[model samples]
Target: MGLNVPTVSTGKKYTIEDYLKLDDGQSYELIEGELILVPRPRTKHQKIANRFFANLDRFVLMNNLGEVNGDVDVYLEEEVVAPDVFFVAKERLTIVGEMNIQGAPDLVVEVLSPSTARYDRKKKSRLYFRNGVKEYWLADPDQQLVEVLVAGEKEWKWIGVFDREDILTSNLLPGLEINLGEIFR
Candidate 1:
């Protein structure tokens, strides 16, 4: 599907207020002031995203580390993005506002779909890195792997890539581990 430009405004940079004004029942992300429509995920995409969210949510809740949420709008700087899965550390829960997350999450996960993989990997990653997101996970259903990136001094740094048989670990969420096999199953 091609990118759908919002009909609400022409040649204007969209803010969170403008994004809120969009009453259309469509998913969108404001990237550098442009309202980019996001397509619905495919079945495989949904499955993978749900699996990841389940694992993370369970572990986070068990350890009392933070809150886990999926498919929620996160306000980042001047942009608004809905990460497939996101985690807010216990101390940063203040960013979790009633309407939407008021800041970047501690960790952001995006289950790659054909429609948004490039933006997820590049544009969104950079935005997350710039806005203080500590970790980023790219779960690719087609590749059956998850790539981990952590915030670095200048940009997002590649941490590791775990395949189906491997286990995933994170520095941000110290004791948590995820089995790639279970996630891809």
Candidate 2:
């Protein structure tokens, strides 16, 4: 028998409070008062995300810049998102509450998977930009590429795209560089 999945009523606009009441094991994000189901990532996606988290966490810890986290609930103004990987700067550490991040993170990384690439590239990026996230990284495992974007006055400005042999650097995290080969490996 298939597992009984929890269901939310149709046409009902949900809030963060309503989202929190969900006890289902599946992952979900609240956007525009709607609950978006997050599909489980594949092995390649997991590896890329893990590599990013490892490198970022190590660098941030060694430099005492801030904290690095993976797949944690982030509470924005009216949305709750779980970035693949994220960093909170030392100055904004207060936003990292016990249960979930209370505000926008300094850097938000999303590993692109076939199921959610469109949302990650457009809707989610816009949401993060509007919510004060300083930087956004979209890692594409299939393409062996990473695209960096910095928040602009009105939208997200493209920084650059790095390939397998290139080294990825961040404007937010100065002097912090990551080898793309290692990330895509």
Candidate 3:
């Protein structure tokens, strides 16, 4: 799962239209203009993502708050990203464009894999914060932990890391609490 070679850069910048024109079968992300290949999720990563998605989906649906989606194209202007899971409140559905999300989502969840852990924590976190993502969650299956980050006016602020023993809760998604123990198990 480790990416022996770091990000494979194109050495050239690309536009959103150009990115869309590429083969959809391949997994990639447009980072600042560099087309970086995203590695396939490992079985453990997929399992964690699926479990978290199910929990978030159920909560959002029951409360009629918003919609929860997985691996969808999210357009952050020139940079297009596909977060592991994203949630947009019902009131902010306008950002959900026909092709892809035109703006940052209310909340984004990323299940870390060995290859993309650093990228997700560094590049993607900064991107999400700058683009107006209210909240971000980094789920680490190996550590069995979830790090919650809240967006501030200037930067992203760390809320806290919840381990398997703690019940994960989101300040943005009020009443949306998830048991970490279930996810790690």
Candidate 4:
């Protein structure tokens, strides 16, 4: 799942709309004027994403918190990031427009693929924080843990870590906890 860093030609300015129009046979993400094209992950990565989606969907539905699905592009004025599984509250569903989501979701979860791990942990985290995302979860399959991010006054802060055999709880969804062991399997 190793991916090369997306090369940004020097001295070229690109708008958010300019990135969406790129059809170079690769998936590109526009973040803070940088263009990153992350290559598709391995089969194992896809399996992990699908499994996470199943558990996430079950938890969200059981608690009636929100809805989650893959392949949903999220708009943040300067960029678009599509998580492995993205969830937005039913009440805030109106933010979705004809083109893309008007803003970030209440909960954004991304399964770590080796190719995207660096950006997922650093760059994307910052982008999500800047865009007013309420909660962000970074699930590391290799490490078998989930790092939970909650918005702070000026930035996003890591609130907790759910390791294997531990439970994850979110302030956004009271009394809803997910066991990490099940997800690791």
Candidate 5:
């Protein structure tokens, strides 16, 4: 048996603005300067996003923490990131830019799907921390766990890793109590 295999490569080369402007009925994200197009997920992913956003929506309203934005383009100078769910505190609500979020948000929450887990954990995490993002949450929909990151003196420090059994807490929010089960249930 002698069969030679051929390598096939395919993807789009897109800039930050190009990727942002492409609302061509496709679900995609920018990772490491690359625009990756993702197919629609299984039903489970939708459920996780719904549950997490539902409770987070209530928490922000009750505590007056500005707004919880989903599918919003947030600009960090050279980088434009779109976290699964992002929370901007009232203090940083003075953004007056042309076509992007002015700066870093108080909290950036990412829901882990197979498509963007590595990019979220590695590339964007570094970007957020470097730009003085206070809190970064990595929510694992498959595992039902969330990893919390807080800005530190040198770098972003891992404050804690929480699961469904634990009550999610945030230092930036003062008296905010988020139920872990509501995230990935």
Candidate 6:
């Protein structure tokens, strides 16, 4: 019988140090050691992200609960992901580094565009879930809906898909709320 063994990775594997060496002019994520460049968001995409960020940031800051950030790097052992919006509780602020957060944020939000829909829903979800993100939001501008997911024992469990008429409530932020109608406007 042949010996059982694990195969070596032929693909290039870059670390956090390597990720830091990249030019700061562009946005990128390191997934499984490969650099994946993120497309620049369109006007509609930026509007959605900005609106949500404004509401969320104000609430979190006023409550002294945590800090809300936009397009910031959340670092993992072998990967670096820049969620469109992410919140880190005040107590967990130690993870915040000079260049990036050392670990996962409490919540990670990704506002999807046509070019990045599949990657955001699949790869990013898996990455955030595996890295101990407590909550994840996938905001779809095309569908005008937001899907909320909470981490579970095995995987992220979908809480619900909220429409423009529904008020979006975040589980991580307890009592924070946002009007989807205003956000989608």
Candidates' TM-scores? 0.93, 0.94, 0.94, 0.87, 0.81, 0.90
Model 5 per-residue lDDT tens digits across residues 7-120: 112465456777667768876655455565655656776677666677777888888887766666677765566666777777677752445577787788888777667767
Q: Would you list the clashing residue pairs of candidate 3?
A: none
lDDT (tens digit, per residue) of candidate 4 on 55-112: 7788889878777777567888878777778778889888766666778888888888
Which residue pairs collide, candidate 2?
A: none
Summarize candidate 1's per-residue lDDT along 1-185 as a digit string, tens digits: 53233333478877878888888898888989888888888999999999989999999999999899988889887898899999999999999988789999999999998768888888888899999999999999999989999999998889889899998989999888899999898
Best by lDDT: 2
Better of 4 and 6 by TM-score: 6
lDDT, candidate 6, 97-117, per-residue tens: 877788999998899987777
Could you give me the TM-score of model 5 versus the true structure?
0.81
Please tell me which model should have the higher TM-score, number 2 or number 4. Answer: 2
Model 6 residue runs over 4 Å out of place are: 1-11
TM-score of model 3 relative to the true fold? 0.94
In order of listing, the candidates' clash counts read 0, 0, 0, 0, 0, 0
Model 6 residue-pair collision total: 0
Q: Give the runs in model 5 whose Cα sits over 4 Å from its true position.
A: 1-14, 20-23, 96-100
Clashing pairs in 5: none
lDDT of each: 0.88, 0.89, 0.88, 0.79, 0.72, 0.86
Candidate 3 per-residue lDDT over residues 49-143, each given as its tens digit: 99999999999999998889879889897998999988999999888876678889999999998778888998899899989999999999999
